[model samples]
Target: MAKKVALLQGNEACAHGAVYAGCTFFGGYPITPSTEVAEVMSVELPKIGGAFIQMEDEIAAMASILGGALTGAKAMTATSGPGMSLKQELLGYACIAEIPCVIINVMRGGPSTGMPTGPSQSDVLQARWGTHGDHPAIALAPSSCQEIFSETVRAFNLAEKYRMPVQVVFDEIVGHMRERIEFPEPGELEIIDRTEPTVAPEDYKPYDTQFGDVAPLAAFGSEYRYHVTGLNKAEDGFPTTKAELVDAEQRRQIRKIEDARADIESNEEYQTEDAEVIVLAYGSTARSGRYAVDRLREEGVKAGLFRPITLWPFPEKRVQELAKQTKGIIVPEMNLGQMVLEVERVVARDCAVELIGRVDGEPITPTQIMDKVKEVL
Candidate 1:
């Protein structure tokens, strides 16, 4: 059978990917570069008997998805820099509440509406630490339109499998660029749903640990009726101030992701097996990094590219290994210098680390990365 394909913007592909992942509810407001994601969801969701709502603001949009998620629907929301800031509090709520939802954050220049129409990777750090408190975070950064689709689907799966909020982040360059993408047929990509409680209503507990690190989540309207709150919760989901219970709950929530780090981290290496210098980048910058590596290799420089698709967990182990093998790692990002810090910490001065950063609403070019690579070597 012939497959279905389309020329789609990254945002549009993200919306379609959410649909493919069985997203039944979308609650979001329009924001630059990311608005197309909400627009596409508004149109596609209804066709599948799914629901889409444009809330009054970003926080409300986030709140609506949390509500929908509690009711057993696969829910999601989309936003950009400022909108993402507005959603931070509730994002923390989703974290503590262990709600399964996806957030598509199209990266634009930031820090009080820095550059709404420009691409930036500044939010890379924000995605992991914007929300208050210590909580587990899963974020994916896909470099191209097709990857945005698959990563969006993976974001949904991770959120469901771990029972928490997962973010799909892409810079404005990829968000607005159109590219050819072949849609994955049903069953081609694995779809995961949150595990439902098998116990009876009277015996149900939202945070019951007996089922393991991630307890089965019960829907509000289902036979189960349990307490839900933003405060530190107990096994039954009720608010708790007891230190022991609170500490254990916090550790459990964080451990779910940390323990499964192997399953969540994803990266792509191009010619790193035998290279003296490596260019480490993500999102739109990765495209430039790949080009730089190819150009340098052709010129007889052993340069390679390392692209991190799953950014939250940081891919620390692989990076540490690369650090030992390579002479240096050059990080070229759209932001001033965010992800470079992470690489530095992991590499621990085992190899030279350099940065090629930009925040003038312009992307870091292959020439810039190549220059930095040459300087490092």
Candidate 2:
């Protein structure tokens, strides 16, 4: 029998999603808007035999998740703006080490402790490049409570599949709002677990890519004993200063994602083919953008919406294809023009890319987007 639908806050649903996805360990320091994620996980994870520890600070929380992943557990951590900033170094570590884990950034207004309770999509770029260096990252944004649950599971599955940290990044509005959600059967969703070592103890190489870009992971207590570190290392997992080895390791880490690009991209479209103008928006603000498109269509304006689910490893090719035929592109985000730059850079033609932005910690209302659509039309 199917489970009955339930009303849930997005944060709580996110916590449930992580647990359902088999996340057995969680370490995080709570901050507003996202605090509910931690609070819920603290209660729910333990009941299901999972472990949840509230660390002294965000840095410790970040490192603990990596340690948990190393121990062969599906681990995760959650936080908001200032907390996300503190986790940046460890985030880079997870990227370089190619650890499997989930990091949920329920975004709020920021720079410092800008607006703890208010919503902002300012962290979109941070999720991609806030860490150091050139690396591949998977980030997903959910605009509603149901998607918070759905994307959390997807984030974990992707992290395990690619041996990379995945970000289930959401904005404050979606994180804190309550909505009805209907969950699909557990078996209906495809779950991807990490590839474990198949070689015997002496034959194992922790970072070997000769077999495939995804080198199998070894549990800490496993006989295939090996080391893992943030420093650039060889297949033996030993740090090396050799330039060629350093380059090769970096390329492998990036190529795994870049080559498997097909499985890592997703987006939502509305009335795109027949429209003359298109609006590209994401996160919670996308809701308003979609509404504006509907209103525009009613007013006889040929407009449509494009909402990207995978923010990093962005859908560049699709944007280029759409730019070729549209009269213009409008980007509306919670921040002052973050993703707009990416859109401007990707579109093949010289079409005008307009931005409707807000950083005042308020939702980008449909009225604002409707006005922008009128201006662009």
Candidate 3:
């Protein structure tokens, strides 16, 4: 039986997604544009027998989620731009520790508290390079309320599957928008749990890669006790400064995803195969890009959309392949051309790469995109 309900705000749907993905614990500090996620989690998690805690600050919020995940809980935390900044060091910790957790960043204007309530897509680069070191991450952006819920589930699944942190990056517009959503029915969705250690506790090496690319995880306080630190470590999970060991560990961390790229990527293309001009947009701007593509089609011009659901570990091969056929690529973003550069680099053939961007907290509308399509054509 399917049920239709009133529109859900994106933030609320995000919280629902986390629950559906089996998140048993949430630790976060409230901040504008993202507070609703915490608010809903507070009410819903307790009712469902999950733990919800409001930490003293964003740093504690991040640390608490990592602790929860270490104890075998599906844990997550949500924040906005400023809060995301505060959580960077711990973000890196989660990466190195290989903690399976989800971090939701509902973006607002930034640098440092530019506009707490306003929408901004300026976090694209931050989500990639915010952490200090060289660690790969998975980031998903939802353009609508339904995606907010669906992608949240995917974030948790990806994190647990890969034993790493995943990010759900949304902006204020999508976070606050209300839209009717129909969720999946029973048995339609697949959930993944973390892999457990197979070796005996006495023989277990926490970071051992003998079994496979992903080393099985043992929960904190388990008989298979081991230490986890941010510094590069050996198979036993002890801090090591050896260059060769460091190289191997780093490659293992990166290759876990690189080797499994097929499972990690999610994207969509509309009328792109036969179109000569394509628009690569993401987040909220994608909605308008769709409209612009439709308008161009109506005016006898061929335009298509390429939207990346997984922002990091970008779909480089796919875009490069598309570039071989397309004549031009127009990238529209809320910030001033961050992702465009990546597209240009990957699609380095004869295709022209164009940018349609704004950074003053104003949205790029369908009209502007339609015009850009014409200009690029």
TM-scores of all predicted structures: 0.99, 0.98, 0.98
Candidate 1: which stretches are off by over 4 Å? none
lDDT of 1 at 98: 95
- CA-lDDT, candidates in order: 0.94, 0.90, 0.90
What value of lDDT does candidate 3 attain over all alpha carbons? 0.90
* TM-score of candidate 3 on Cα atoms, chains taken together: 0.98
Instruction: Please identify which of the two predictions, 1 or 3, would achieve the higher TM-score against the true structure.
Output: 1
Ranking by TM-score: 1, 2, 3
- Regions more than 4 Å wrong, model 3: none
Q: Cα deviation of 288 in candidate 3 (Å)?
A: 0.3
Candidate 2 wrong stretches, greater than 4 Å: none
Better of 2 and 3 by lDDT: 3
Which has the higher TM-score value, candidate number 1 or candidate number 2?
1
Worst 10 residues of 1 by lDDT: 368-377
Write candidate 3's Cα lDDT for 142-217 as tens digits: 8999989889988988998899999999888899999997776544567889998878899988888897778889
Model 2 lDDT-worst window of ten:
183-192
